[model samples]
Target: MARPPLRNDLIEEITTRVLDGRLAAGARVNEVHLARELSVSRTPLREALIGLAGRGLLTAEPGRGFLVPPFDPDEARRLYTLLAELEALALRWTSPLELAGLPDAVDAVADEMVAALERGADLSEVDDRWHALLLSRCPNPHLLRLIEQTKPLLKRYEWCYFGGVPRAGESIGEHRRIAAALREGDLSAASAMLVRNWVSTVAFLRKDNGDQCASE
Candidate 1:
């Protein structure tokens, strides 16, 4: 197969497994196994691994190749705190900027979330897409890049963290509240909401897991 297509397919498979928590945090990975499972050669698998390491989705050791990055509770909390401040800043800064067509773009995520929950679905795709879209609205490329790095790392323990949902309808409530705040140019409330939402999200996700880490 062509390098580009083969690379894409392998990346998709790897991403799906990771997001689904099938590839657990700190889990060992085997290139040969991945190659066989993906029905591709090691060359493409190696290339995908290289790119993923650069993306901070995996830790690339000199001899270890690719390992699921460690899931440290303290580290995660610190990262979440940083993200909250960053998001607060982003929300404040992003409030006045006019996004002519952004309302529809964001509402699409809300729509998907509602539809997914109605069907008793995972809604991970809806969640991730909404996250990326909202983060992209931040003016600084560096801020966006920082969030991009953080999200993938947190996704490993995501399932064990969130596990399941009771009233999935609540997912869209924040979406509506945030959107309404953004529409009214209420930067202060929006910023506080961003901080509160993410800070609570980390605690909510960690509640059931009880900080399942070696250090803890």
Candidate 2:
């Protein structure tokens, strides 16, 4: 059987499964069963699990293997807070020339997202593309890595609340503002909007999830 490259494909598949709620949070990762189900061997599956554990999606337990970390509102807040800061920093680090050039690409992504929302397609993938475009000018590899690490975790909350594109109209308007700021080479404005995008989502989750926010 052909094994998809574990570093990228496997990890992405597992992350999708987790995000889609197929691999429930706090559920134990059964490597044997998962490997069999995926038609791969144990080694690659274990490697993928370890990669996820390192990314904070799964927690390691001695002897018992990896388990999905329980959702904690405090921890979610901290992660989202850090994510906002890191993304803002990335925008600051990006070059003005590059930022000025992103409008067309950003518009394309936003258009696709809007179309997808109307079609009831996967909004997460569209959202990822939009955010990725915003960070396209960031030169620091380490900072980009940190941003990637936080994305999947934040995505869990995003899925819980937005279900891909519930707030599509408002979100499209926000994207336009961010893209316009970037086109004008206004890094400070762009950075603020980037932070607002995430922090606002956290707020939305808090408002909608209510008493269940902590458990989610």
Candidate 3:
């Protein structure tokens, strides 16, 4: 029999499912089906589920096992606010010398996002790469780790936001502006733009939800 997947690997696999909407929000995690599909026994799978719950990615209730948490606009707002401040602070901490070459690198990723938008492709991954490059020079490992851990919670909402072609176009423009600010050696401007980038996403998601509610 195939050996059970390692803990980290199992966590990653389940996380992917959650992020991609394969498991879906507010869905109960079927431990049996998941174990059988993953070719692992229930024991290891349950352990992974409990771990995910601890990470706030899943909810554990009495006799309910594990469940994918429902998407909440309030939660998204709080997360986006937290991420914006964290990333902006990271930009502040990045040294001038480290950011010297960032503009060109960031522009390249922005161009890719533009091309993806033209072809009706997903821009979320490229957008993420741009943000990663923007903050690549941050010296604090702990701050970076906090950013990394907080980002997964917002990925599903980002996927929704990027699904709209116009929204993706707007994001590309915002990215270009940030890069332009960096090109001029203006870290303050770049940091402000970075925060605005995230804030706009929250606003868009909120408006989109409102529009949906009105239509319904």
**Each prediction's TM-score against the native?**
0.72, 0.84, 0.89
As a TM-score, model 1 comes out at: 0.72
Computed on alpha carbons, the lDDT of every model, listed in order, comes to: 0.68, 0.79, 0.84
Q: Summarize candidate 2's per-residue lDDT along 121-213 as a digit string, tens digits.
A: 766678788888889789999999989988888767654464234466677777888988877778788789888877776655544563364
> What's the lDDT for candidate 1?
0.68
**Which residue pairs collide, candidate 1?**
none
lDDT of 3 by residue, 167-210 (tens): 67787888899889988999999889889888887767656763
- Which 10 successive residues of model 1 have the least lDDT summed? 207-216
Could you tell me which residue pairs clash in candidate 3? none
Regions more than 4 Å wrong, model 1: 1-12, 39-44, 95-112, 135-139, 163-171, 206-208, 211-216
Query: Against the true structure, whose TM-score is highest?
Result: 3
Ranked by TM-score, the better of candidates 1 and 2 is 2
For candidate 2, the C-alpha RMSD (Å) to the true structure equals: 2.8
